[model samples]
Target: MIARARLIGVVGFLIAGATGLISSTQTWLLVSLSDGAAEPLAVAGASAVVLLAPLSLTALALGAALSIVGRILRPVFGVIGAVLGIALAILTAPIAIQAPVSAVSAEVAAVTGIRGESAIAELVAGITATTWPAITLVAAVLMAAAGIWVLATARLWPEGGRRYQSERAERRRSGGPLDAIDSWDDLSRGGDPTT
Candidate 1:
């Protein structure tokens, strides 16, 4: 169960982060102009939520770090992940529910050279949300659940391996004789291997 929990937490965060990053580059809303332009203006997730890409990157980093960090840091990372998930949800939920005129202001400005909230609102005939926002919301929920899972099962996870420890530390712990590799390591560190 411990191993399964660890796997779940790691995999869940990874998938959620990847999906969120991908969705951030996708269209989240379509804005129709009151003037009846041939095509509607597209508002990307990144424009709608500027923090989306950064938050997703953080989630990816957190997932990678969680796999190798010791028990002490697990809960800390878990808390960060939970907060990130909630933040993402908070930023995305409003746009998903009803995209405000400000959400498409950038696209409108770029296309029609119109600026300001009122100006963009005047040009926008309707705002329709795309599927990307829904997908991002689901990913946010999964990320939060994975974080909570980590917090609950951190103590049950196995202790981190000592593979990253220096050979001298390993030898001291095991009381083993120094090997050729240890001699090379000592030499590389400006120590007298003969000593």
Candidate 2:
């Protein structure tokens, strides 16, 4: 049951990470100009001000990898990842609720290349909507849930054989050429190795 849970968590983390990464490139806000045309602005997930998308994605990836290895430190990493995810969600929610005026204004000015007191600038200041940020928030929540699951089930997870095995022991066991042979064979007809 623990193994199953861990597997589910790993899959969730991976999916969340991928979703966050993809959404980061999408437009977060739409700025409407004076001409009644909507201009897609910067992505919330990739915004420098938020800085949550990449961080959350990276944490989810690390958590998934650690969970797969079944190491003793998996729980620690998982908790850290979870906390990061939660932080991402918390930070992004407000941004999605209302677009930052200063940032949007600067972006609009840069994009439309219209100076102050211009009709376009006024339109840009008044036009802002939350779209992509909501998606990022959802991804962050998923990642956080996955990390928490991993943390809870990591101790019950099965240890990987390679993780505990020593390199010297493996080398010593395969010291001879016959170690590579699966079974001995005779050149006699109608001979059965098992018999």
Candidate 3:
């Protein structure tokens, strides 16, 4: 059913967004000192946001929006979200490969309390030896796949239920004894329940 597809799509986007959020906080760069003490350059999701905000934030917002909007608009947003995910993946590839030498060096210098050109060079070398960029790439791929799934199946989603309807509409229909009570209350307040 379309409703089921819509639910699945919503869940997919949510999972993708959650993954991206988690990936941002993960350690993207690691620095090992000469003494064999390994330290993280940036350990929070906030640091990753500096480099991946464009992609991560967009996916989060789109996923949240998809849950509220009607079925007809789901696919359109899905495609847009998918494109953003791909862009994120593309942008992340190089950072993952090269390890952002300068940034990592600066972070290492700050963390290790090292203050010499040679020391910085050694730290940079140590930092670059590790691989963390793959995290972002994986997150990006998940987001893209979720978006694609939504785009592919949105057309089959069912219409929203009465809960999505306006409050006024709920008062208009004559149901059981409760319906008369509701209409009477609306009329007493000088409000047209039918409207």
Task: List RMSD in Å for every model shown.
Answer: 3.7, 8.0, 5.2
Q: Distance from true position, residue 46, model 3, in Å?
A: 4.3
lDDT of each: 0.88, 0.65, 0.67
- What's the TM for model 1? 0.82
The better-scoring model by lDDT among 1 and 3 is 1
How well does candidate 2 match the true structure in TM-score terms?
0.67
Sliding window of 10 residues with minimal summed lDDT for model 2: 178-187
In order of appearance, the predictions have TM-scores of 0.82, 0.67, 0.64
What C-alpha lDDT does candidate 1 achieve relative to the native structure?
0.88
- Backbone clash pairs for candidate 3 read 2-156, 2-157, 2-158, 3-158, 24-45, 25-44, 25-45
Off by over 4 Å in 3: 1-3, 32-54, 102-123, 128-132, 162-195
User: Per-residue lDDT of 1-195 in model 2, one digit per residue for the tens?
Assistant: 775876777777777777777776666776655655554555344652346556756865675577556466778767876887798787777767776554355566666676564544466535455566777788789888878887887787766675534543554467523222222422144444343
Please write out the lDDT profile of model 3 over residues 1-195, one tens digit for every residue: 655776676676666666766666667766555655655445333453355754666777888888778867888888987887788787677667765555455555667787766667775545542244676677788778878988998777666565644444654454423366676887999997575
**Residue ranges of candidate 1 with Cα displaced over 4 Å:** 162-195
Backbone clash count, each prediction separately: 0, 0, 7
Global local distance difference test of model 2: 0.65
